[model samples]
Target chain A: MHFVDRVRQRLDDAELQHNLKRTRGRNAASRAAAVAAFPDFDAVRARATEIRARVLRDLDLWLEAFEAKATESGATVLWARDGEHACELIIDIARRHGVRTVVKSKSMVSEEAGLNAALEAADIRPVETDLGEYILQINDNEPPSHIIMPVIHKSKEQVSALFARVHGTAPKTDIEALTHEARAVLRPQFLGADMGLSGGNFLIAETGSVAIVTNEGNGRLCTTLPRVHVALTGIEKVIPTLEDLSTLLRVLPRSATGQAITNYVSLLTGPRHAGDPDGPEHMYFVLVDGGRADLVGSDFEDMLRCIRCGACMNHCPVYQTIGGHAYGWVYPGPMGSVLTPLYQGLDKALDLPQAATLCNQCSVVCPVSIPLPELMRRLREKQMEQGLRPWRERLATRLWAWAAARPALYAWGARIAVRYLRWLADGRDRIQVMGLAPGWTAQRDFPAPAGATFRDLYARRRQGRA
Target chain B: MSTRDDILGRLRRQLGRTGSGLAEARRRIRDEIDTPRSGPRPSPGDDPERFIGRARAMLSTVDGCATMDEVPAKVAGWLRAQGLTTRLVIAPAFAGLDWSGAGCEVRAGAAGPHDAVGLTGCFRAIAETGTLMLRSGADMPPVNSLLPDTHIAVVPRTCIVPDMETAWTHARAEWRHWPRAVNLVSGPSRTADIEQTIVLGAHGPYRVHLIIVG
Candidate 1:
């Protein structure tokens, strides 16, 4: 079975179709309300985009400056070129600290680097304290299908089952009961963990601070309770100053989840101060490049502007249909389609960029306004240039392009095809199956072409001139 | 030591190649000698109340709670209503509050499993971001705000500030004498991973109740 098909099967078993539909509806309504509520949302987003663009334009300089300042602040900074190196550095830190167990909040970069698996292989256990992440961990599952909501694929029934299995209790379908059960299970992990790990949403170069946003107090506890704290983040997650961070904080939650702000926004500069009563004795920031530096000065540079809001996915029809895991990466949906091929290389994930319908919804709803469809097109073009396009799809696109280049032939072909399609419909006005178009017709019936082709009608209308 | 020198030498070489090392050193020296610009002059349009209102709106979307008077009782009431037990750990900041009249055993110290709820007073609330600040101290153990089934925080009305800038100013002043972990909480623990269903209380407190003490 295909990757998407496997995800579909899981989603079906989990009975998440209704929940996804409801979430999409709620998200749409809330986003609309948030936009309406904050009339300055567009201005804020534009300002944020400018700020990010400026930062990326001079990223090398800013990064070096940040490193220098952070070093001065008594924080150790490690730069990783890719996921493997990132995982290695984090594991090395854990080893040095003799960390047996690690409590963590949500960090997409860590997920992207597959940190947990690496830590486990190194004989270190990493515990996820974020509610959604904790559920995913309990199930021994993959990184969340969504950026903001990791376990958006499971239903209450499935959660109840997972909780029951983990806690040795009978399954309870109530949402409240399931939440309580998870709380009881995770309480012990928080206290016993030796170190805390997190991801920074923004890194302020001005103050050498790592800013993390969370709706849970776990982010705070995870950073403060342990003797060692490690922050793993992508290089692009930096901003020039606190004022710039403020601008982003204003727009991030509103655009992502229709919230004004997340619950907890913690800023950590370095390890505990001399007089501080509680906090980690040691602090480390792992700045992972992971193909981001390559994006600088490139056509796809805007992709780095993402704040991991999952807004584009929420608004995407294809994502709404298939859900996240289909994209076969940490990220999924429209944003995932554009990002996967870029980060993983087009050769490795050729099918991803072609997944979009080019409806342009992702671009419109993006807080940074990334032009995702255009980027996908660029990826497709690159794939074709590399001769990696599937033969069938290549042949189809080639034929369409050829026909389109020859208007006379195209006009005749369109008329003939329309007539043939109408005949095939047999008065039903829709075709249940379309040869060579199974990807489309498999899900829904295609409407038969109208009586007269546009070319034919236009020609007839211009008969007087002829 | 050799590896460290090698890395440093490599960085130094890279800096020399870019011709930015000398410039950067000069810039750092200048920054050390120069004073930072004063806070952006407050505009006439900047209404603290209006800003607070906007910030509150943002906070509420993330499940931030606000209340008035009798914070402990209100918090206890909320927990009991959620079917949580009365056993709780009270922060030293609330030591003077009479919880005996509320009919609950409020122990003052770090939290335990028997403690279903934890209550504490926030040092300040930033209305610009709708965040409640808690600094780690003898009275406020970071775990008391977390690691419990439910968390109840008390924020006095006057402690609320308009934005992060103001909050930073307040924090800087407070941390001048003693620096510790400053926690800014905006709402309860929530996750949207399960089919985008917003589930509250995943790993931390399942529910958070805020009592606004005027």
Candidate 2:
């Protein structure tokens, strides 16, 4: 489907629009608060970027060292080349552990690898314990629409309806009521589950520790309650030391939700200590490459610098307008647009690269300064080189490119196009056309090209000076 | 591909010739290290009060919360007003408190899922970041703080620090003797998934009442 059409569909969903509006307002307020709180927010962002860059540059050395240290601490480390490999590794662990029920906190890596479906196919139940995730899971729908808020697409009323259907009881419209219901259901699963799965926001190479951040206590319960704890994370999550982690911790939550820090930041070094009263006995860390290693040396290496703060998405006009589902991936918004193409292949995600308006707001707001817009442009260039562009678009761009190279020809062409557009617009100064450009004007008016070309205006001004 | 096959394949591809041997050697090394180290260690070189100040600053920046002497009454009133009163699991730190006067039933120890409220005392409060750290143990079972409809934490004013670094140092020193899960809570649970709507109490406690006992 066309990008505009998909966005329109998401916008048409009243619940999504309502939620987006509220989240946008809250994020704005929180971000302002965070900025006010951290006068060194920019410095923290820069430091985080530098640390991440250093880690990515020496990824192999760090990975080997981290593996050695983690294994020494009595934790098993597994490497997966891609999502398929990651899923296989998890499934194997589940099979060996005889995992009948799995309780999960919010792990973006699991979502990316489609771990839930893979486990269920093997007859293992995967339960999402995060309140938002639980609501989405009960609905039995697609992956989360937002990175932090998985069910951002569902309104409280919609959630209430879904809960009522799943539990065979009328759900309350109140937020507390909804949360209480989810907690009631998930608490038992946390105790009964054979394995607990989570995603690490940052992995400390020096300490062999995985840092999991969450607001609700699910992340902690998921790691400590179960006999087996599995952490899935991209290789880019690694940092050199706890000091580096501290720098990131200072910035990530502030950038993400405008909090000084999340409520729960659990750093697990290894399995339960010998004398420790609680915590998992078997701890596994799955480091998935998933096309990230290739990005290490490429221009897109900066993408790895991301801490998944979701600030870019939060500030993105397109994201705020259409929401995440329109991107059609686990990682949505600008980061997703850049990553989906890289991981899923540009051909599979042809429309995603074009999802943005090249506004550059995403890059400006990005904590890590990934140059998202430039990377997106490069993806578009690659798509064009691959001849993936539609026939009509290719012809239009080709014609424009030809004219653009020669200013004299471009001026003449522009003059003719402007006259033609004026005629088409008649006296109204607006024209509704179908085909490729209709999406641009579907809900908003497209101003007719200015009556006078830039060359014409410039020449008239010069003449007036004469 | 099977999980074993996948893991084996990864091991072979990444580690080459030393993969199997290294795996075995690593396992042996872990088994060999049985006793905890008790050697004299260098000081961390950071000041406790400075870290506490930082914690306080962080909490203030993040809109940290604190309760006062009137907190018990406020909490009791809030819970009662919310029409929720079944059973409360109180932390050992809260043992000396007079709950009978507040007209609330309080049980000591971990709370079951059916329990209406879990009441505990925060070990440390970071004022800079506005966070409360709760360590799991006999008195503060992790479940007592989690797995309840409402979580009421009684944070002493004295334990409040300024930043996480101070909290970390204090926790690390405490864990050297007895290690357990340390939970740092900043605010009530929240989510913004539905069109980015910020909704509190997604999957955990919908109501978090801090009874700050000065």
Candidate 2 ranges beyond 4 A from true positions:
A1-5, A11-26, A418-443, A446-466, B1-124, B134-144, B147-160, B169-180, B187-214
List model 1 lDDT by residue over A1-466, tens digit each: 4665765675675456765765665676678788897767787788777878766655665676677767776789888877888899989998898999999988999888998899899999989878788888878755688888777766777788888888899989877667666667777777788999999998878667788888756787788778998889998887776667767887788777888777677778788766455678888988887777667767888898888887888888888767787788888988888888888888878778877789998888888888889999998889998889779878989999999999999998998899889887888888988875777898799998868998788888899688
Q: What TM-score goes with each of the models?
A: 0.81, 0.79
lDDT of 2 by residue, B1-214 (tens): 8443453344344434264665665443343232111211213323334434444443311112344435555556767777988357787666666676777778877677578788877778765555777876666766676667688777665776655555666665676533335577766666554445456665556666665454
lDDT of 2 by residue, A49-102 (tens): 777776665565566667776887789998887787888999999889888999
TM-score of chain B of each: 0.74, 0.64
The reply for model 1, stretches above 4 Å from the true place, is A4-19, A396-440, A445-466, B1-124, B135-144, B147-158, B169-180, B190-214
Per-model C-alpha RMSD: 5.6, 7.3
Supply the DockQ value of model 2: 0.21
Q: C-alpha displacement of A51 in model 2, angstroms?
A: 2.6
| Cα-based lDDT for every prediction | 0.74, 0.73
DockQ, each predicted model = 0.29, 0.21
Give residue B205's error in model 2 in angstroms.
5.2
lDDT of model 2, residue A461: 98
Q: Any idea what lDDT model 2 has? A: 0.73
